[model samples]
Target: MRGVTRSAQGRGELTPMESRILRAAVRLFAEKGFDATTVQEIVDAAEVTKGALYHYFDAKDDLLFEIYHSLISSQMADLDRIIALRLSAADTVRAILVNLVETTASRVDEAAVFTREMHKLNADRMAAFRADRRRYHETFREVIDRAQTAGELGTVVPADTAVLIALGVVNQLPTWYRPDGPKSPQQLGTEIADFVLAALSA
Candidate 1:
């Protein structure tokens, strides 16, 4: 099993050393493929010693796991809390999309690295990642499924299909979403939500 950081972006979740190592890793990982980025390079980039890097992460792969885990864990926490509010389906979906966009946009480097290197995670880490992803997918599916079952939304497609379509676009944003672009993540999320709700409402 790889080392796991509780929350990469959460204030106080990581020590200053942990944060520095993580930032350096994201930069290096984004610039060079994970296979090409060495631990010594990470230490030099972060200006930390080998001991500091090893203290926080078990190995380079552990660093990779941490980079991807932290982002999803953060998103899942937001999703869980928003869903607990028991908002109407449209509102819940809006909260989720907006949060997802904002979070993903803020962590583009992590997302990009994960997209390219995630298949390398160990079996245990892979299982954990899969569980986190499934929870997120199922939660969103339930929202749509419940709405359709209650006759609140049009049944244009299965809940799984709708979820995949919605997540697919956001997941691909790493290739082209520019933080300096005209729209802020919030605005983009709202626009996306509007489009998705339009489909459900029709």
Candidate 2:
């Protein structure tokens, strides 16, 4: 397999072919369910050749992994950038929630497919996913923990519990979120941040 490549694929920063293939696969996986989607279907939808598809991915599982990996990697990058800014605890938490919601909401199809199909992932992919999630969770918790310890934030709840609650809302959002809903992801994220910050202060 050539593996996933990142070229000048418009604003998504993926290769044009890679972007089309991934989008096609995610749409098919979401609509037909992963078990029912096939490599041929993806290739046809993407308008790419079998050799082109094989050049980027070794198998169907690789496509599934990449579909999920793309979002997580982007979120992780945003988190790193936010942390580097060294903002206050509240500011940092707000940034994280907002970024996460926007990212997760934008490509909700990918998220939905992963949620329902991730159990089929191989052991290595499973471990990698778990590790990335754990790191993101722990890193957020630590930010809250440090702030509380330093007297910059209130200890209204344990940082672990707090982080869990904050992330829980975003993770389960795909089931209910609508692009045509009352609020955009940005607005919803702010409201969420407000509620969390208020709870912390109280």
Candidate 3:
């Protein structure tokens, strides 16, 4: 499947100040909730002026959208790359899961904040987010569907159901996953992939 275009398409790389402001916003949004976070608080946390913050992001809503947008954009790129490799269906699925887990784990704060506060985004941004996610979901389901049709995977569960089961765990990572946890993200991802592939084989 083609990579979904980023919401911030045509935006160049973020300057250092922009990165600082985004990091501060993610931290504050995760800690204090989006509505409670003020622009002044983000500036204070980022150690930048209010003007600096506005220079990169128009409002708090922009920060929220950017946080998740960057993540999903990266994931979509990885998905396209994996699909282009022409790997076996199981290998492709494994690579996608591993990449998703590691990336999400690396930016746990961003994921957590976005998951908790994404409802605050403007309608346009929200629609963009949903469309990106739907593309990812449909692409993944197509992979499984083709594999099943070719008899490479069993039909123990429908492709859509399988996608939901796989993604459900990743979506819940923020609530319980810890950076200092016993299992590394890659390890957790492998185990999850093992379970998923096993189910498909059954």
Candidate 4:
């Protein structure tokens, strides 16, 4: 809280100013470290005033937490929706993986920001966020676990191993993904999912 201050129980969700500030935070935090970024720098890049920035976020740490929470929370909803569809385990897993790829492609900057700047969070918030992250990973783990029990997939793979492999494939896409490249985002997602499904088959 070395910067400005505001209330957490503001009116609605993120306002335009808050959105701008969050976007700027994502960029700056990814480019410059957390400690290196200043409120002035964020406001300057966001084209907003100090008052505007603080009106939505209390401090830089608050802004970072807000961004992180927003990203994870929304993705959880999306993943849950996809998982609720009653497809075969393999098909469901593929759909989830494809969804992940598209999501990463859509928000590579946020992904990078979240992954890189996570350590900058305060201890209390970090512990909470880590718990949330573990729950998120459990969604993937549960899917693989069910598949294993049903004998639909190879037992050679462990549940957590499936989660890691799935994440590793989807997370790496942002590093080299191009929207207008050879594959469409959906196509790339399907391809990656297919590879994972194939590997798990035997």
lDDT of 2 by residue, 4-96 (tens): 333112112457788899999989988998889999999999999999998888889888877877787778778889999999888998999
In order, how many clashes per candidate?
Answer: 0, 0, 0, 0
- lDDT head-to-head 1 vs 2, winner: 1
What C-alpha lDDT do the candidate models reach, one value each? 0.85, 0.84, 0.85, 0.76
Error of 3 at 168 (Å): 0.3
Candidate 4 global lDDT: 0.76
Regions more than 4 Å wrong, model 3: 1-15
Q: List the residue pairs that clash in candidate 1.
A: none
Instruction: Give the Cα-based TM-score of candidate 3 against the true structure.
Output: 0.91
Worst lDDT 10-window in candidate 4: 2-11
Give the TM-scores of the predictions, in the order they appear.
Answer: 0.91, 0.92, 0.91, 0.84
Error of 1 at 37 (Å): 1.5
Model 1, 84-104: lDDT tens per residue? 999998999899999999999
Candidate topping lDDT? 3
The residue pairs in collision within model 4 are none
Query: lDDT value for candidate 1?
Result: 0.85
Say which prediction, candidate 2 or candidate 4, comes out ahead on lDDT. Answer: 2
Candidate 4 stretches with Cα past 4 Å from truth are 1-15
Ranking by lDDT: 3, 1, 2, 4
Against the true structure, what is every candidate's RMSD?
A: 2.6, 3.3, 3.4, 4.0
User: Positional deviation of 200 in candidate 2, in angstroms?
Assistant: 1.8
